[model samples]
Target: MMLVLLLLIYTSQHALAVVVEMNAGEMSVLLPCQFSGFIPDDPTVMWTRNDLVPKSVHVQHKEGDDFQGQNQRYRGRTKMRPDALDTSDFSLTLRKPEMTDSGNYTCSISGGRGERTLEDVELQIKDQQVEVKVVEGSDSVILPCKTKHDLPEDTRVEWTRSNPELMLVHIYPHKSDQRKKQDGLYRDRTAVNKDLLRTGDLSLTLKHPTERDSGGYICTIYRDKDILRQKVVLQVKGWFPPWATALLVLLVLFVVSGGLLFHFRHYFMSVYKVEVDSGVESVLLPCKTVAHLPEDVKVEWMDSDDKKVHVYQSSSDHSDEKHQVYRNRTEMKRNLLRTGDLSLTLKHPTNEDNSTYTCTVYNREGNILLKKDVLLAVRVPQVEVDSGVESVQLPLKTTLHLPEDAKIEWKDSDDDHLHVYEKRFDQLEQQDQVYKDRTKMNEDLLRTGDLSLTLKHPTDGDNRTYTCTVYSKEGNILLRKKLELKVKGRVQVQDQTGDIRNRSSSIDPTPLMADQSV
Candidate 1:
């Protein structure tokens, strides 16, 4: 027995161990390296992937570094700090790491005698985030979170919202979620199907997400004490009255309305409604150039009062013109001159941020090129939804161009398949019984990246999550979005006399006869 114990101890001494795990697409990760004994000053350090033999990830000396025959996989990724050796640090840091870079990295330091093993760290990169955009007034929304692995029963999954408010979004303790401790804002508004969780899905279904429902959500899964995290940022855009401002803007800018439209060419202007989570995180106002401009072109964002939101001039930002309300709360995307993306970002938007702003692009000669009006709408999770229409249409539109053979599937809160569009046709046989003959889709729209679904005779039972997932023929998810539909109960009616009256419940208005439909 003593001999066996001694052998086990010997094996443990040289056993390979994974010291770190990280998510993919992270900015950077440091692989720690420390010599077991005999700390050498100004020693040479080399990091290599065990799988890729005869190739070093990084090579550094006391003076400089040389990567003559480094692997192409880590050509521009691996680097070492200049003052690393001064602090007995021989760690290798990888920048802009990808999921494909997962492997066992071996670090070694060379001294007067020879090379000494420092550490063998195994790096694991999780999947990149998937985006799912939902309109604010939707009855429900689906926050998709999943893992391809069938984890152990003791696996701990935590969903929390740290921005805007540090609230416990959801917690899946052991086998099931503990909802009693949930915040009052999300007590019954959140749900996770047990059957779907068993099949490796941790997606949460939320009911009645108003403008406030937009924010950054973090889903963390802990298995065997190793933590794997996925981040999802939800942008809940609200639908304001469009026609209310359309006629007014047209009258102010058109020739027929005592305004100038000829020389200014206001028709070239663009319009967008930006969604922001209330007190959640920063919001983005997307503004990009339709045509590239000069290197020193100027970009200005201002409100109606000519108050500058952000002004880029003289090759740098002019913070002198920044308003007091927006002090130190805005940032522009890096390298905008190269990418022609002139979007503006507002940090930690709150209800006070609901307003209109104008983004203008000017050439180096101060020539107006493009002007866009962006409306910032904040969304909050509310108890009610706007039930306006009679045969509700659960909007699920995608903006990405898809191939002819893309696989699209729409599912409900029950995890049942509601609609399946694949193989260049809609598979009616696989649709759930609740959706049969009531669902419709425009196959032509799918090719153009529009995946909006039309629901007929929508009832209160349909006030649930509707997730639409677009997949490639090779089973890769191309795009996915979730929307909610709520049926109108207390109908507000308008008759021919321009008389408006509110009707209680589903009862028809007195002006409508039994033979007439809504």
Candidate 2:
């Protein structure tokens, strides 16, 4: 039974341990240590620092304990909660952390076999804020990333380039550890505080920092497997401020104000181009006036046929055309007296919808306030043959039928200056030297837009990219296809003795002979 009880106590003790975590730059922190299987009796807990002569202390649950040692830096600053001990809370609170207060600390219990555990807390103190000013092409300026934290003796602090393209001038931890490079323009300009490494003072000094160095920089502190990082920005400036800097600033403000006025005037007066996708059910056309006009102003929307779609005069009255095609499709969104929201929306679209619409606004005095026009282009997909395909063979030629209104243009890729056939004009009988007597299209299919051209003598050199562009009253459409020519030829040689040998004798020789002769 005694052995069983001992095993239970051991398991409970192992299950209950203390944990301490300190955030960077935290001044006060609670180091909570848990003690399981507590009897609630008067327990004695003590804390100590890891130093040459460790500062130790003892505390009682009833009366508070203060453990300020001969180290004047941490005097009268450590304490623990009174109720924490009764509830098995052995947490220690450190006050006002300093550079000297960084190291491993231990929390131990003197009751029930005297158990103790050690944990380390790292304290990082940020460096003083610095302002850097440097000029372009001037001498290198040094910006330091420093801190005031006491680190381990063998800790390594480094200054690495945040941007790899920029080279490091130098890194100094000691006089003998100075690194210098000849090729880098900033070779002899960078340095750091070497003596402060053990104390976690990672201050970086940049030498000859250029305008390119006006970015982020990192200072890293490495100790064993732990790392602490800090970042700072180095700004490069041109020159210093003078007594008349305020006047110069005012002058700049005046110039900027004038420039903004000019820009707004130009933007208000300039005509804006409106583009819309085809098949759109509705579109809002924006028309806004610059300044205030008389409340009794008139606005109207006119289509290409000079037909009035909608008209608005005064704030309460609107005129509509009953017989218009777009009777319910268009309306004015706002009044011109307050907001110039002359935006209009079209309800449904049709192929006959291709036209340029005009927005005209007139003031009460019958003077034109604003006049703007927007071209509405509706688009449809049309299949057509591109320009560069000089010829098509027998099998491919049968697939040349296209839909209606498909515009086809044929031009030689080798010589674009020559036109093979234009839809508005008849086909040219004579071809250019490059395509001489080699290209022709089916005459009957030409009326229906079958623009498949056939080459008499196809060659590999005729392979080229052909662009087929189709235009409609709505808009323009484009498609591209590549044509590659593969020619098959037969050669025959007859001796004077009348002995004739046939090339490809089994095949019909007429087509091959005719193509080769061309």
Cα displacement (Å) at residue 7, model 1: 12
State how far residue 173 of model 1 sits from its true place (Å).
16
What residue pairs are clashing in model 2? 140-208, 141-208, 142-206, 145-204, 386-468, 391-453, 392-453
* Weakest 10 consecutive residues of candidate 1 by summed lDDT: 380-389
Highest lDDT among the candidates is held by which one? Answer: 1
Candidate 2 lDDT tens digits, 296-394: 667778777898867877665354552367765666665554565676676444334567778887755465657887666544322222223444442
In angstroms, give how far residue 487 of model 1 lies from its true place: 60
Which portions of model 2 show Cα errors greater than 4 Å? 1-46, 49-111, 115-220, 225-248, 253-518
lDDT per residue (tens digit) for residues 148-208 in model 1: 7667878777777766557777777623346655654565567776875478788887765
- lDDT of residue 117 for candidate 2: 56
lDDT of 1: 0.70
lDDT of 2 at 269: 38
- For model 2, give the 10-residue run with minimal summed lDDT: 380-389
